[model samples]
Target: MNNQHDPLSSRPLVSSQEYSEVKNEDFEETACEDSITQRSPSTELPAYKLRRSAWYPDMRVMISREVLAVHLVWLLILAATIYVLGRFTPEVKCGVSRLPSDVVFGDIPYQIVNWDEDSGFVNSDPLDGKRWNQSREWADSTDWTPWDDIHPGSWVQVAPSSKLGISGGIPLRDYSKDGSWDTNDEGYALTMHHQIHCLGLMKHVFISAERNEPIPSTSFRHMDHCVEYIRQSIMCYGDLTLEPLQLGSSQKAIESDTWGSKHFCRDWTALKEAVWERSTVGFDRHGFVFDKVIP
Candidate 1:
């Protein structure tokens, strides 16, 4: 072909190898662009661009403190609520709800009688000398008095023989083998009597045992003396109504007669009625109602 007139020679002539190399270079550039476009945003983005301004160390610390403070405030509020509820709640009272079936002994309410002038124990040492001698002799004697003929003062006559039984003798003498006086034994007896007297006085008076106040030894002794007087009267009169006797100058003796005559002797039937009235017939949640019955 003539170079000046040929159509293929009109444009710049390229080698076959050069054209192939140019096509391959263009394909390589396209593949590099596609790989860059497909890469993850995290790997492609700058560190500054990926992190927010609010997520800086100082800002993060401030946010954590605020969250912690909110939790602490809520915890404090909950604790305070619990404390208030505990402080204001009413206390619950516990006790037995039922009455007892056993016979309950209680102190009979009696007025104090002032008969100090006529007490039989006044200036008389019943524990020693002539009285002691007589008592000792009487204890050995075999003379017996019928229960029907017994009177208020008759306890003195029957006490010697009755002492052989469980209930009649002074606790100290009864506990001793030779009937010797023991201060400790006497104290123990008095303590027992005091307990019994307190039970009698408080019987059926309180709905719950926890509500009852402790009885003082002095008060127990006073009540015991009064009951002892009544016991003597019961022993003597055998339910007979007798005039109140002058028991002597001792306050115990005088008070005994005063209270005993009014409660035990003068109105013996009434006393029995009172006991019946005070007794309960139902089952008890607590233990026995009374420790002992005086009569």
Candidate 2:
């Protein structure tokens, strides 16, 4: 019989080549599917070829590192700026001095006593009375008003000696040939009054006991006391300094006494001007005129 027609030959043995090819194809397809399943989302595409919407596997760590570097650089810059400012900026402490118990009067120093008491009774004599009368007459004859009429307060006393008169003593011809107290004297008096007011001390209005003549020792002592009180007030109210306050050339007139004589009034005015100038600067820096009470 022909082998092709034989039933036994109809189910010929399957070729080993065909079986091997089928098995190989199946194995390759399974390997491909396993590789796709095991891959992370980030690594599915090449880093450079990945779409803008896709995330890079290592980009997260790199971006975090870049951000951290930027923050560190900013922090370093801020620290450097603070250091520069602290190193270069100047420090200024504005303050004042204390009042001493004793102050200089005329050429000699005297102790301050009875600060609350009136200075009117310190030294009164027959000559002082005559001088006082003369001063009153001078004030009445001229346009000047009486001290009591001008300043009405317990701190102020109306006495012949306290009257505003010409620069000369009683006779008037001794100092000023014409019996006239110029604006200089008025300025001095005004300065004295303001200083006393600033001190907030005894209210006696007569800053100078001997109004028309040179200051006497007792009167000078009183004047010195007032000056000390003013100095102390300035210290308490504003910044203190060994150097005088400079208000520039515009305020030069305040520094100098345009009034003829070199008296306690002139000296006191100088002190006042100094304190005012310093207080102005303090105000500009600190935003306050005075730091403490006047007293």
Candidate 3:
């Protein structure tokens, strides 16, 4: 058999299945003319341009309304700068960090100003009234003591049986049941010399306490009404009984010339040295002072 021209019938016809059947008949005639140019509805898109660039708005929609009006003008300028810094600021306050006063005041006798007016209290007053019975009867005839060199308005005398001792809270009456008045330390120095003769008999002088007894001419008229009540109330008045001086070496007492003739005063050693020098300046033992301060 003479193989017809051999090499698989002369190898010259290229095909790949006739070039895939003419590329599938030219892609079905270009999809039938692109579906007759999209069904020929005037050949394209239009119904309001197929309505959509994000449903009709443009330049990135005014760049999203200028980014929401610049985030609502930066949230209304941060809420009007926090309402104008809460309507014009300024309320800070803060204080309290203290510790520095030291305490000074010197000359003292009366103007203390605080810590309860140094203590004697004249202000909040009331601690057994009549201004503490006229400041303990004007400190019993303007108190004085080195055992009694009587000084301020003097007129000493006192004696519900002497040796003074009525410390404040007064009420130790029983002047032997009934004589009502007498409360010790010579009936509290004759009720503080009748409340210093009701505070206004001017030039101090009090003396009244001779309920009876003792002589040397009524102790020289009770020592001449204590040297005419310290020579009509202070500023000067002397005579401290010349001699028997020594107060400690076992106590002694015999120079009593009484007030006017000076010397011999001891309303319990002048109200215990004017209640320890008016309670060490702050004035207490009834003078009342220790002022006050408390936020």
Candidate 4:
């Protein structure tokens, strides 16, 4: 018989060689009483490959559970700090108010029609008719209608972000030396809309100069100076009221004489008087005009 094929010939005759008897001391004496599997105290598990995330480098070091948790917490804190810093940094450019414009002086941007005076110009539907109500007037009302939301024709589009070519907020309505008399909110005084703030100062300075006399178109250098002046003057308004909302004893105490003048109403009045006196004496041919409108 072939030894490879014959089962009896291939198997060993000695049964004792294949099996060994365990000593009674080697086995747990109390295993049956406890009813639990017996395991050797010296046994060890085989080493296996460790898996890791692709983003993190596998730093081959024996790490404890507490150590690994600490590392993860530190990484999370670092990521959060970077995110917060990016939010506050001014990445995109924008102005506090309207952007600078290319529109120069003497450009004749829009036409003004005196609606109340029929004899002056032919009345167009828009510029010729009684378009607004004149009954509601604020005590500290100014000639400018820039902030008046009621009148449809008085609002001019402003590029507050500086992306648009326009410099500052311009009221849609215009009033000149012509016989245009209407309390209907058709036009605004030059200083009406220039709020008591640092923003839109270049436009305010230009308007102020234009109202005073035959000044040339506003220069870029002059605008820079005006912006600095406005910043210094109007910074106080952030904490307190610079311009009063109405006219009265209480209003006079809080409000400015001119809307944006840095000085208080009482002080601005004194300054105006001084300017007028100087002009009258021919010390200065033209003095600053400080006119506050009250309605």
Candidate 5:
């Protein structure tokens, strides 16, 4: 090293007091900068940097208060959307996903029924307990019940059915103890049962005619109601199967036969399943509908 005339060897190139002042100023500036950096990276911005990070934004810097507020609002909106979808919409099952909708109703299927008019149900003797046994599904009303108990209504008339249920699948009742009000009991019979009951009445009337006995006034009333009911049911069922008039053994024009009449029909099974699921009180003969849903 050149020791002579060197700045280090000679009196300082700059005065000691000046150097100390500069050094002190440099040290103070560096310390101030370090403190500012610890508090925040930006000077113009507020000292709002947080130690903890937002769950969504894992950046080293804190999220703005306005931004955090917006995120909370968005989350609330999402929750509300989910709630609305679940509340107002009707839940209909569609594969893995259930669709909620009032416009989409359930399905009712169909089947073919080959009517057997020659069957024992009608062809047998009315007095042989054959014609009337059909109505016996409900508690025996053979001069027992005071009024009609198998059915439910203010009116004792207007209904019947078939391929539907044993007794139109209606819940039966014991009318034996009832006076004016309808009483429900064991056994199930639908509207068709009522029609069958009417037929049974007609059968008794037929036996009376055969024996030359006077028909009861009630029997006449029942016969009239039954005739009207059957006529209306035919209109309602709308069995459009074409039945051409037939010719008798004498080659004369004879009435068409109902035997083996193939009818394109609503599938009782599918409709039955849907009915039970939706029915307030069903084949089990219990309860009525509540809140428009089967409980």
Candidate 6:
């Protein structure tokens, strides 16, 4: 028989030469309890490759769980603080670099209001005589309008954030010439209010073949002042919109119609809301809000 084929048997095998060289003492332990597997007090596992997250660096010194958690929390706090300062803080710069990037105020701080029939500003479809109904203190109803309020002094409110152009508010012009913020003479007024008064003054002087109405003989100076003022205002907001000159019967074909000309405008609605919200009714000597209207 071949020795190679004989070695394939299931039984344990030892070479005769190696067995002859071994001493009997090598297998000396024979106690029943000792025959079973024994143990040392402690054992060590093989070293393994550790994985650290890309976020945390592998400092050679071990970082404790509590310290690592504190570091993570601190990082989160810093991130939040940066976010808040960037988000809520208002911008100080003006002219295109304002807080609200979308809102453009190339002209004046104004809220866009459509002067359709509802406004009574342009189209005559809007009815008048409703001021008394909505007024703060015109209940008894002698019937008042901006036109009526021009001569008599009145009160007005102002608080300037210096955010837009207007300072806390425009100084209350002593319209009574007495100058009070809507004191005993009348109630609140604004630039538009003053503009209306000027318009009323000029309206009294304007006369035409349209019909019969007494033309007040107020000084031509007041009339001229208003006329020039209105003229200057029209020129100031020079509508740069290209009103293409068209040929007409008249030689000066400077015929420009602004019936439907559209221009970039400020959020007039937002401005009005802000005005009403910030407008203080009255204030004391120390500039605190109260019942007494400041003179």
Write model 4 residue lDDT over 150-256, tens digit each, in one string. 22222223223333233343222232223232333222222222332223334444454656735445545656666676666667445343544556576555544
Each candidate structure's count of clashing pairs: 10, 7, 31, 9, 14, 10
Each candidate's lDDT (Cα)? 0.35, 0.34, 0.34, 0.33, 0.44, 0.41
Candidate 1 Cα misplacement greater than 4 A, ranges:
1-44, 47-56, 90-295
* Per-model TM-score versus the true fold: 0.19, 0.20, 0.16, 0.20, 0.37, 0.37
Candidate 3 lDDT, tens digit per residue, 43-122?
Answer: 23334434543344576787899999999999999999876654334223232111111001111132212111222322
**Candidate 3: Cα lDDT at 146:** 22
Cα deviation at 105, candidate 4, in Å, is 34
Lowest summed lDDT across 10 adjacent residues in model 4 is found at 280-289
lDDT of 1 by residue, 31-132 (tens): 334343433322133345336432565697999999999999999999998765443333222421111111122233334343335333333222222211
Q: Per-candidate RMSD vs. true structure?
A: 27.8, 25.1, 29.7, 22.2, 18.0, 16.9
**91, model 6: CA deviation in Å?**
13
Please identify which of the two predictions, 1 or 2, would achieve the higher lDDT against the true structure.
1
* Global CA lDDT computed for model 3: 0.34
- Candidate 4: list runs displaced more than 4 Å: 1-67, 86-142, 147-295
Question: For residues 182-278, could you state the per-residue lDDT of candidate 2 as single tens digits?
Answer: 2121101233344533332222324333455445466546667777778876675563213333455786543532223322112433443433322
Q: Over all chains combined, what TM-score does candidate 6 have?
A: 0.37
Pairs of residues at least 3 apart in sequence or in different chains that clash in candidate 6: 111-267, 111-268, 112-268, 154-182, 155-181, 155-182, 156-182, 159-168, 160-168, 174-179
Report model 5's TM-score to 2 decimal places: 0.37
- Pitting candidate 3 against candidate 4, the one with the higher TM-score is 4
lDDT of 1 at 232: 70
